[model samples]
Target: MDWFTIKNIDAIDSPALVIYKDRVIENIQLLKGMVEGKVEQLRPHVKTNKIAEVCSMMLDGGITKFKCATIAEAEMLAMIKAPDVLLSYQPVGPKAKRLAALVEKYPATKFSTVIDNIHAAEYLSQVFSEKKLFINLFIDLNTGMNRTGIIPEHATQLFEAVQLLPSIKIIGLHAYDGQIRDTDLTLRKHNVDKAFSKVLILAATIEALSKEPLTIVAGGSPTFPVYADRKEVECSPGTFIFWDWGYKQTMPDEPFNYAALVITRVISIVDEHTITTDLGHKSVAAENPFPRVHFLNAPEATPISQSEEHLVAKVPDASLFKTGDVLYGVPVHICPTVALYERAIVIENNTAVQEWKVIARDRKITV
Candidate 1:
């Protein structure tokens, strides 16, 4: 039987997310092997797979540190008693208070966040100080992503200024070179090195002044291999947990497999060359243009248009397909696609065993 083929397909409804339990475990092992079995140097991000069970699998694999993008994701990791969690986002406004409350609620889990400017740093300090809580922070450096981070040239000055803050302490440096995704491994490495050189210089300057070494957390799935070889850096790659079609086609060097899939069924035959399925924009990640999802069973069917509840596809012969024919599909982007479903059916030994709630998909979870 195929890896995704379920013997009891009749029990599962259409337009449902499914996870292969064995493949997930294997992906965790593959991630560990990439770092030479040193789980200490790894801080896998939880934003990709927001399920608590998947985080528990990483915990079982001896991974203690984690990185998240939201308060809900951080709370999910703390609920599982993850040893350490770094909120990779810059918490501002009421988010600062929410993070402070989360820290007080889960004392067992060490919580930290990233900061790129003095304004955010001062705001976070004020919020944490009012509650008599001390928070750790990593200097978010803009290593060419042009996203949310301080430029390397100005990072040291901000670092020195933030050192005077009372309630927050600078603990590390975070450089997310997400834009350096060259298919050629050599070219990718060179670009990563070029971007990271400034960060290394900043780290050295900060350590010289503070009289301590700064912990470095860097990279995502595409840039993980470049940072894995560095002993001083903690690599954070979230998508390795559930590989998607985008990475598989772009980065063939990484060998992670597709561990999750969306199951859909043919709902109607539009014409001799066209058909519609239950998988629609709401069922998959539609951020990309056409072909948001690739159907494994019906490879020839091309998704031309999608609506809220229907995805119209052009096929060679619609007469060959009838209603209720199950089609297994791999989403082009699995992170947002997983958020569309509240629960995922767990598959074990080709049988539907149980459902795992996508608890962290919510904006808030008991913070």
Candidate 2:
């Protein structure tokens, strides 16, 4: 089987992360078209591409609102001077203090976070109150994805309790429908409508009781398209920045292209049919099973095993590939895989142009 090789594969170090800038720009444009030019309705999550350059690219495309999963990600957005930012993850202990400090430091940027319980809200209020500051918050609604959100029934109570805290202002509701992964667009929309119906009801009830306007940020990569057109919902899709193999196969309807790839080299030939590459668990996300990476050149190759620094795959004819030959692979899960790398080589016009630092990969930022 023939494999696609990079133009300057010999120049790049082995197991390097590659980002196609032109494709990323194309993706941004496609998403913009998906939302019908209403860029404000798209609050892309920065957890996918943690690079500030990507954030700047989004800003250049008229996307200002951003969502992130860590303090460091939020800091990266703030550093970019993004008009609005949401720390999608709930913080505790020093993280909470650090969040308030982040808000204090970036006064020009609007900062918000998600909360499911009163304790987190109260703690954040106390932390911000000590600093004579306030932070915006959205109540995370558990719409079937029982990860980090309050159930719809308890949202009203949480909203009321949060209002009492002077330092934290209730902005809206956040519902992450990550579990809505039906490949069929119709079935996917059905699941999204059913799950988001609860969010809508809860939002209406909270708004009626509080007599305040509220924005709803709902859905992840899968359900973003379903909610993008809704008048009351702001879609926060992360993986759209760099489409991966998993979503490409699962959601074939999504027009986004793969903007990221892993460039690895064959290190050893185990036998006539078996070979090992430098791409490994540390290079790509191992959370998924074998075939974590889809080889663009050798589509028939089957991944057998993966270690910290190597991936073993059995090909129809391993002799076709020699040691030191570069291979391009699209990761099954690009988000976590991105966090594993410290930097990515930015490719433009099929040539390496620059490097983008994955600054937000770290868990903390010195605010």
Candidate 3:
């Protein structure tokens, strides 16, 4: 479907987020093919779309397990009656209490979280104990991404400690290889395999000590394909559903399509070589460098400056464009970009069908 030729473009407001329903379904099918039709092995992170509409699409496509970074996202999944949901973030203080309440409120969905330290686990245990609940958990192992996970060497010790806790259940290990971005398939595979080897060993040790099976959830969009075929590991790739220009340029060999776009309009014609659009930092994610989005119709355009409400771009021939002309752009980072908008315009058959609320955009939802 040519989203650029959507007949209802002029009616919708500028700088609006648009999601192509058909493209999203196609992307889900591609992901299923990657995992050999094993939807249970795919726990897609809902932090990418953050909308129940997309979650329903995933459910319709037979994807049951899901992952999210915030409680709000998990609540959305629970509201939609997702059978399995993993809160892939460490809950601390009140957030820990909130996680317990959320699990209690949504009894139909199985909820879990990740932790790298004992303090957080102890706090979660205390909160869950008060509510008489048991929360499943995965040890967040820092394979190489010095982010929010425990070191590989400490995984066994942390698992042993958590196993004794009364309120939290030690499910398995979570190793997010977000640092591996090599487009070369061989190099990427080597790095991913090296990281997985550490977690696999830890998984074996934990299984031996606990005398039970362990489920390893690993990898993101970049390293998903590398570990999808691993029978023991369940892949949680969020960006595969709504791919962006960032992955397209970095992992050129991947067959995922762009399912979302930021629709902006030319608000002003600065000069013969320049024009300004309504897209700005508030409209799209600005964490990346310049050219935060790729214009599909104007590839020669280079973003010069971006303010809160405008994005000035220098084009090869500004005469070809005029004020009020609609421009569709693919965000470089689709995850955060989706959070910048309150809702998305659902497109199908070159027409706007509905608006899906960005339900989990906020950090908290009164569970």
Worst 10 residues of 3 by lDDT: 1-10
What tens digits encode model 2's per-residue C-alpha lDDT throughout 193-261? 998888888888988998888999989899878987796789999999999999999999899999999
Candidate 2 local lDDT, residue 30: 97
Could you give me the TM-score of model 1 versus the true structure?
A: 0.99
Rank candidates by lDDT, best first: 1, 3, 2
lDDT to native, each model: 0.95, 0.89, 0.90
Query: All candidates: CA RMSD in angstroms?
Result: 0.7, 1.6, 1.0
**Which has the greatest lDDT?**
1
Candidate 3's TM-score reads 0.98
Greater lDDT among 2 and 3 belongs to: 3
Query: What range of 10 consecutive residues in model 1 has the weakest lDDT sum?
Result: 289-298
The superposed Cα distance between candidate 1 and the true structure at residue 92, in angstroms, equals: 0.3
Over the full model, what C-alpha lDDT does candidate 3 score relative to the true structure? 0.90
Name the top TM-score candidate: 1
Write model 3 residue lDDT over 100-200, tens digit each, in one string.
88989999999999999999998999899989999999999999999889988888888888878888988888889899999998899999998878888
